[model samples]
Target: MQNSDSDFFGRQGDEKILYVVRPHPLATTAALIKIYIISLAIFFVLVVLGSQIRVVSSIFYVGLQQIPEHLPGMR
Candidate 1:
């Protein structure tokens, strides 16, 4: 027998559900834009740092060449 006191999902007759809260579309869009800008800034900073490190390493390696190749472990 189907029970009138309960619906198909099992909620009682007295139960009432409140409306779901959500952010406005414009607010959500602004948040996404902020995240994208911050991500781009971090990416550019890393690229610049990587290039700087390569340059410094090359300069240091050139300075090491003054030592004779016959020294132990030197190639």
Candidate 2:
């Protein structure tokens, strides 16, 4: 009787330095699709966050520049 580990852990016999895995076409396609979707979503989120940071930094810089230079201490 074949042990269930073969199916559970993939084909098992001997460990090779480099081995090829031939998965089902549908499985490969589905996995690639999911990776692409997740990567795209992450890319979009980063873009939005970067835009928000840029806006906030610009506002902070402008406010700092607007501060009065003539404080009544070291004059």
Query: Which candidate has the top score in lDDT?
Result: 1
* lDDT tens digits, residue span 39-64, model 2: 99999999998877633346546666
Model 2 spans with C-alpha error above 4 angstroms:
1-22, 55-75
Name the lDDT value of residue 58 in candidate 2: 60
lDDT string for model 1 (1-75, tens) is: 453433335656777645545689999899999999999999999999887763334644777756466654433
lDDT of 1 at 57: 43
**How many steric overlaps are in each model, in order?**
0, 0
Among all candidates shown, the one with the greatest TM-score: 1
Q: Which stretches of candidate 1 lie over 4 Å from their true place?
A: 1-13, 55-75
Note the residue pairs that clash in candidate 2.
Answer: none
Model 1: which residue pairs collide? none
